[model samples]
Target chain A: MTSDHDTPARPAGLPPYAIARQGRRARYDAASVHAILDAGLVAHVGFVADGRPMVIPMAYGRDGDTLFIHGATTTRIIRGVAEDVAEDVAKDVQVCLTVTLIDGIVAARSAFHHSVNYRSVVVHGAARHVTDPAEHDHALRVITEHLLPGRWDEVRPMLAKERKATGVLAVRIAAASAKIRTGGPVDDDADYALPVWAGVLPVTTAIGRPIDDGRVAEDTPPPPSLAAARRKFA
Target chain B: MTSDHDTPARPAGLPPYAIARQGRRARYDAASVHAILDAGLVAHVGFVADGRPMVIPMAYGRDGDTLFIHGATTTRIIRGVAEDVAEDVAKDVQVCLTVTLIDGIVAARSAFHHSVNYRSVVVHGAARHVTDPAEHDHALRVITEHLLPGRWDEVRPMLAKERKATGVLAVRIAAASAKIRTGGPVDDDADYALPVWAGVLPVTTAIGRPIDDGRVAEDTPPPPSLAAARRKFA
Candidate 1:
């Protein structure tokens, strides 16, 4: 239902890498891209490894246009970026990061036309290791709060030793695009006459009741923030 | 809890590409790999385009050890593979397919240790066009049933012309590995003493009420298969 007047202008120039094959589905507005990125719980990060493409799912968080991802310092991907810097081959790691939230399964009369209703954001950028202590701390807070709202304040602040072991990479989205498909299935006119049911089966990620860890004291109750999150998605 | 006696033997020898930096998290048994792939609703297919890694989310189905992915013949990924074949660069398209199901959000006492509980499968292999008519039809059936358990039988059979417009690729399970993390968060011993609520917030992909297309007859009820799916998730 997006009309030319209602659609937001593309703030970031639409780079060739971000163009969609189905031009109608491509969106370049910052609002559209950020919304998809915020809704997704995990991002699949694509990077070249030994001349082969490797895609790994990782939890991510965003602050403005910068997306933060972290892993153990010893992990292959983190170390790979470090090696790139040491060799001076590249200042940042080239990556294609994607986040997708599937909204429904679109069942059409014809199998060829069956599709899924989804919102996805694809970002192409060079990720560099975050060196500034202030930015690193803020990025960690963003990541922690993204998964658990109000968690950064509730939990103990990260110890210096723990910070040393974590590798944080910040990728300022150079070029980004959001592709969304919603509503009911779009089938061929001739196939609409077929005596078959066609519609959308909505899909959602629901959060179930919280389970306490064994170490928790019997008197200690679930935090209000945790309980609220469970209720929000329940 | 996985016991050494209960863990299945690794059927496919661990390929260098399948190994995880954290060795303890990697599982190579066919059972482990297949279970993760089955539970996931989408796969992120990684392929090289113009020497840059492109990761796109796709709906996929698994039959035995093989995975099938289909899209419109006009799609960029499909056409890219076709061009590769036409140029005689390689008979198959090199791809890294990944599927991930986020089971829960792990809220740890320290932000550095926060992680998601998930099961993921990564398959490194070459995908080639499924040109055989019988295999193409079977692959389509696998895809239909994978999304909606009994959908293939209830839907109208695909018309010849409909099939002609679809492009399907099959990737054999070569060098596949599964990585899983479950249970509550594991925090540092000192941090565990902090009075912070830390546990797993369970997550699941649930199906909501179906919305029928307006074109369907007023008396035409939702098929039994659709009803069954709703109940399964409910």
Candidate 2:
């Protein structure tokens, strides 16, 4: 589906880590990359701790070209980078956040040939602390709106003390790449004769029936955003 | 759904990181921790590079209590940990792997309070290189079978060169902990009167219609393992 008119305003370069599969290579364009990020709710953030690597999955949101992350103040990874003071231990470490969606399964006849069809975005940049109060507050709103649009205006904003207690960070998608795979399975010619069922098993995200909170007022109606997501998915 | 009859076989005393979460605090129980790990497919792994932390999502398998990970020889992270290598980089380092499943989206009346219902597992331990060829082969099979049961038998075995070119490493899951949050939206009593949705949007893993591989022989039948998984989820 890629065409000259489908390119995004932001140009997409190649991934630093590239692997070739002859016919299995994915086409990269701006629209394709943004779509993957928009459809995902969680991101796996990788960083170093004690001179070693670590990965953590957390919720994320994007504002234009920037991505925001929020977490507990007690988390060592966030606190270290924010305070710039290594607690009796090293801190101020660089981190990378990645989002990926498993679109389908590629069932190849040869075991070595089996692969998962997926869309993934990897952001490489320095993860510094957010010291500006206004910037921090807006970042939180961006995150909330990203998940539940229009809900930010409906709910109470964060308190000064509460905001201080939570750590929020932002990184631009300046140096990043997206990879994707779609379509039927690929099998070796000789193995095609072997009796086996091989094909993609599609996976999708759907919103389920809403479970009302026990304490909700007997007649209160759900907001349009909540109702709309449910009805659309249903 | 926790049962009083179930008990965990843990070491004599509670480890520092294995604390239990009762109320809003996170606590560690052996059975709950193991269950979270067993249910996960892959883990985000972290390590440090040039004063920065790098986290990569990778396939992993567990046996007894040890976690195994492998990668191509050319990967910087793997080569850094190689033994008798030209680089003076430490081959072993402290690493953590985390798995999380978001059960639902808890839409609280207050935007600042919005949170997801999730269960997560974190493992902390020292990673050691797997040097023995036999252990290396066994580890690779575990990784394959973990992703696809009965896959090890169907695929061609690894070649000698292939095994040598791949770096296999194992880490004991010690000082591990798990944290979980479940239930409907928890909103303040006053917020209940506000005209807003307060409930959960349940999320589930679903498999769709399977697409047959074009290259598969017409007479081929689906494997039992794949069929069984489909039925169980269906």
Candidate 3:
């Protein structure tokens, strides 16, 4: 079902659909793409429904080249894809998933050049529902571990009924691109000479002190895994 | 060009296009929607191109109910909208703009309940290129101040040539919805009795020490605006 225009040659390793608007900032290297995807906690999933575009934020995990996302069976994304599958077995749901991390705010001497230092990854592919029991179980584990390393080992195992209530969508990294903009503002040549102060205020996501759910026993302390996760970010 | 299905009754104060899938979490209040949009520094813009959905990240600003975003004139979004304007003077580009902020990671006793506490705002409407000089100028100011308060006054104003080079698009908040999830994970009753720990790990975006652009004079100190911005986030 793919058209010639949709399947472009992978020049410099970048998939045709994932080309960056800025040639200089485009990164197709697998390592770079994986790093950006791994570092991000949330991804914006884009899909077309009834010719209207919808973007929904969801937590995701990457197992090699496959990106896994799960939700309740009633959710729009899951239900929409399910309906599409039912209509035409040969067609998969087309999606464009994107992850962006804002590194810093660039304050330029003029409003025209104001920008932000950021790293973003865009993935384009067909998302298929993972119905196999083994793959579904593995996808859940990957997702839990992706959010909090060592969490899956400590958490109770998924029950048969619990697994059935959840639906996992796996999107292969068929075409992906990463774009990064760093450093300070690049202003108009004449405006840099102005007396205005211009610099980068670095932005970072920090994990604050953990708050217990109050149900934990008084003797119980923060787990080592939680402490390690905090330190990793710190 | 609005269709009957495209326009729905906003009985809850939410625009038809901005309806939330979860009725309980949906917020149509202007205050709530504005707060989420203002706090976020970037927006994921969803648009359709050639029957495919594309979501691109861009810096944006809000003034009253109108949202402003700018980019190079040659960019797909800008170019696409511009072409639409030329073809029909009465038509505007349809878009869905979304912003999401992840507040915490919710770890449940079982893999099925893992989630993230977040606040997200979705706005759906027609985007028109800002051709009015006064509105365009004000939009730039709002954008600069949105990133860093007290910034527009200190920085040099946009030059005529610089303004000409940029394409600014304004999308009125015709239909908007905000969804927020907070507190700890809501786990299954049986899993809560398990010994596994379950709680929310709070996440915050912090500003690190500012970095000078190297071109600034050595004697120049960090502006009070920068300090104020940091304290506001802190």
Candidate 4:
């Protein structure tokens, strides 16, 4: 069943990452891609508008190999894409989606050789509008649940009018690659005694105590799943 | 004296965030521009290649609103920019630079209404070539030390030939904006009893103990600045 949802399978290894990817390539598997996407909460989205490459930072969610993004209907770029598609215009729309987790900092003996330890996934594809209401609803759910687990069950469903007003699109993960760097810094032999501090400053994401909205009467405690996740991170 | 060196002369009310700058439709002030560049460790660089917008991740540093990025000299994008400048020609170049910090996740009563609290800066600019040797060297130092903190004082400096072989360009930050989204999720009054979890999953960058390179001589200890920073984070 899950395989049915797998990103339109790419010709094996069609979009190999550049030298940077080769030098720090991760295990390119479905699990790896999903894990990286799941661990990430924000994505830097890039697209061309007015023939200029523009990047916007936004919240995103992923299911299988498909990534879902949405924003205000007033967002200029989003409107442009929708208008172009509504006109049945065959527009060449290229979108690049990327997520990065800076696991640590690699300090090398030589300043010239310092590097960051990170896991990043870069996806390149032609973005198109999702016109079908059911599919659009599902995509929005994927996005919502990605940010807050079990959220789709708790919130009021999207109304027809509101859904129409929000411009949401689905970018099928087509050409993609995962690049990762880990472990300690690589230093030159001669520079070993240069007396520079060289090591990995590991970074992690942690959650804090939950603060209830003042509107909640009696300050209701957080939900079970939300409370459990917070404890795990804490 | 320390304030003068510790903090750049930041302009008053200059929004230091790129996304906030964009949302407010603010202009690029020198101090706001510098702070965004200096505080960032890397940038998502986008450009048109083969009539497609390609977003590449890279490390960058800033001197004022002018940003410097480095890569292999033989790279196609770098070569193209250099040729255009060497011939005193103008080419279509569109780039976006963004820096973002994810503070927390805002979970609303309704799943469709989830959001994130973040601060981001975006720069829309035409990236040009930097061919001057003196300027390139200065940019390299800024980029290197910006990421590694105090490593410049410990590592062997770059050589003249090495610097020439590496492609470095300083692109001015122009037409920038900083848009910000903060606070908890906003949900409709009717949706409060949905029985779904609704609270922010606060995200923080936690730096952990430094892991020394195994090859380092057994007798050596971490430098005071680095060791102390690690302790502080610990």
Candidate 5:
């Protein structure tokens, strides 16, 4: 039931469905997948709800092979993983989590060749409902720190009420792939000689100077954690 | 069967399932949804693939209420829109297209309340396999122009062979919602008085100076289309 009905030509270790027949730029190695996931800030988490598919932006954190996402226990995903195709399956709700970082815009001589320079990872796995307090606390910290590294330690600890209200879902990377495109566009060989100008317009996510809230002292500078995040993003 | 099990308290015009119960920030108006979609560069498209959900980042273009995504004719959603719940449904394929723009990082005093400032649009609808030649060509142009406003006129027109090889899928947004969060961190009243500095670190996608490909003349300046895109992105 994988997306591709063609011959199974995927590299070793990946599940058949994660074979990545969607495009020509797929890379199946874990290094590429982890790197893209670690660098990404938001994940487009797709899950079924009421027989229809829904994709939403969510902040995620990576712990080894597992990806963590949290929200109110009442949310569609947190409440249930959606109906599984089979009752015998381990988990009813499955998820497709995708992360992408657009590196640049490839402007080619031909419109057909125009493409984006990007690095992305797509993960398919079961949505494990996390209830263990220790695991839930760790997942929250991981998610918080993933965005602003050391900011988690500087911030107040999670209160009991806060922990109770939050629900965590873990998706183990059962199958995944990273697809990347870089450098210049590959134009039609004949069009490469055309008068049109072609090259890469690099697109990057830039972290700007931090603006402090009014309540903080005028002289109070950004903390070390913020500085660390600044360095990483810069 | 929409995702939410809550009362249909949605504003007029939107379907019950399109209601945003995911978080506190939700905007159902077309203006907000279109604005976010227009500014976005990549869309994470989710559809049922082999009984499980799959989400992949795609470059998309908007034409009024329809979102167009093109790929090889054999791709999952391009060939057919996943499965429809009922046998008698008009089209068997349903898709969820989502676009997100990260505006900033909210640095809150409590880890529990920390969040990202972003604008996102999610659309759920039936995926129509586009085959009409004129609409197909126009959809491609719309997609190109959406990314680089005037690049279509500058680049060589898409060739007949290119069109033959490509497949376009249009999703007339059945139900959509936009969510936006902005400004500095909203900390607890007591924590706002804490000595810790709190602020927002603005996150932005920066388009850098365009570099010409080797084939172009050294003095050949970037075309007007690229300049227009730079102005828009800048």
Candidate 6:
């Protein structure tokens, strides 16, 4: 569990545009969306660059209804948002951010019926280039702690230069939806009696042994934060 | 290793527009890009829908320079590509596809220096709806076999009705780039002397023991294909 300091309670509902048309597995409540967001480390961000679609994988953190993604200020996406902030017609950078966790692979009697058990959240939003000092600092903390829950407290405060060099985009989700698929594969009634063996092959992101940077004392152990992460992610 | 049957050789080079501007970690050769793509199961496909960007996670397979993504004909992305095929001026649907594999997390004394070791590939191309019977069949087999390698023979073949209901889009890659990051965190020289513990937390995707669908006899073991997958992914 994350330290509950600034962790806002999951915001209520999703916008109409964000509701899944294929409703069987759709989740509209903020809690459902937040759960998947918190569990993932990378988001695939889709945006229009030069009138063409572009997708980039990024490390992100969720704060209630908002998601923060950071990168160097000079990067293309960051620069695009900065320019959008100045444009008279465009007030914010539009993006579709999605995170997915693969839980299992479902094998069925027929190739057509094979499916996967996964949890994914898609957020459509107008993102702003974070400029306010307080919000910027908070976003950084959310990102740092999101990856290693307690690391923010163990590390020194952000440096002025470091803060300036990084860029944070805050995507206040205008619409969001989460889709989850679980359990065993559903096959055709006739195919069920076939000789084929079918089931789910579980998949997971495993946190392996940590290696020392070797700059520190050889015997020094990983900090409390990494230890906490080992337990949390596992 | 995948049971080699019709595995095409990696295509040659990337287009100029697809080449990474941030050249430090960019790989342009087909071999490097294919290695990451082949290792991945899902691709985040980015496309423009109704003048807005949309990102969807899809199962895809690669053959030489071509990538195939299949779905029901009614799906928005599939329909969009079909319409593009009919348009008088534009003959194909343009999209950006990306895949990522997280290898490890770098924990540093400073949060600013923290990073993750990952390998990712981005592909940009115009996709054509596959209407040829032979190509459609090949695409379906590729999609199925991509998930559980060597399982195509273990399952029943796709029926005619199933073929009629599915839409396969072939993206002949026009531009592509792969970026890879590895090893320990690079910290500020002065920060290395701090007493804080720093290291690399290794991460990996693990394939767990298979669970039976229970329709078959309980004693039946997972087929040889799943055994190969466990060894390959592990």
Which candidate number would show the highest TM-score if scored against the true structure? Answer: 6
Clashing pairs in 3: none
lDDT string, candidate 6, A1-234, tens digits = 000011111222445234445455667778888888898878888888777888888888888778999887766678787876653343577788888888888888888888778888778887788988999999988888787888988776789999998889898887777778899988888897778889988999988888887898666667888877777678
CA lDDT for candidate 5 = 0.76
DockQ of 3: 0.43
Name the 10 consecutive residues with the lowest summed lDDT in model 1 chain A: A1-10
When 2 and 3 are scored with TM-score, the better candidate is 3
Sort all candidates by DockQ, best to worst: 5, 3, 1, 6, 2, 4
Chain A TM-scores of each predicted structure, in the order given, are: 0.86, 0.80, 0.87, 0.83, 0.85, 0.88
Indicate the worst ten consecutive residues by lDDT in candidate 2 chain B: B1-10
Docking class of 2: acceptable
Task: Note the clash tally of each candidate.
Answer: 0, 16, 0, 14, 2, 0
**Candidate 3 lDDT, A1-234, residue by residue in tens:** 000012221222335345534354667678888888888878888777766777778778899988998777776667777776753463467777888888998877776667788888777777888888999999988877776877878878888998988878998877877778899888777776777778899999988777767676666566665776576555
Q: Local distance difference test, per candidate?
A: 0.74, 0.62, 0.74, 0.64, 0.76, 0.77
Q: TM-score for every candidate vs. truth? A: 0.88, 0.81, 0.89, 0.83, 0.88, 0.90
Choose 5 or 6, whichever is better by TM-score: 6
Pick the DockQ winner.
5
For candidate 2, give the lDDT of residue A211.
Answer: 85
On residues B1-234, what C-alpha lDDT tens digit does candidate 2 reach at each position? 010111121232245345433324354667777777666645666555455555555667778677887766545456556743444443565666676665777778886668777777667776777877888878877765555666667655565765776777787775666768798866766777776768887866565767776766676676654654354333
Q: What lDDT tens digits, residue by residue, belong to model 5 across residues A113-180?
A: 88888888888777777767999899998888888888877888889998988878888887787778
lDDT by residue (tens digit), candidate 3, B1-234: 000011221332344435434354677678988999988978888777776667778878898898998777766777777777753473577777889988987877777777788888777777888877898788777777777788777778777887887778898877877878899888777776777777888888988888878778666677777887687666
- Chain B structural similarity as TM-score, candidate 4: 0.77
Q: For candidate 4, what is the TM-score? A: 0.83
lDDT of 1 by residue, B142-217 (tens): 8777777788887778889878878788887667777888889888888767777778889998888889888986
Model 2 lDDT per residue over A116-186, tens place: 66666655655656667898888888777656666677676677776877677776654555666688766
List, residue by residue over A159-209, the lDDT tens digit for candidate 4. Answer: 777687666767777666666778887776787876566788787777776
DockQ, per-model, please?
0.43, 0.36, 0.43, 0.34, 0.49, 0.42
lDDT of 5 by residue, B111-165 (tens): 8778788988888777776667998898888877777788888888889998987
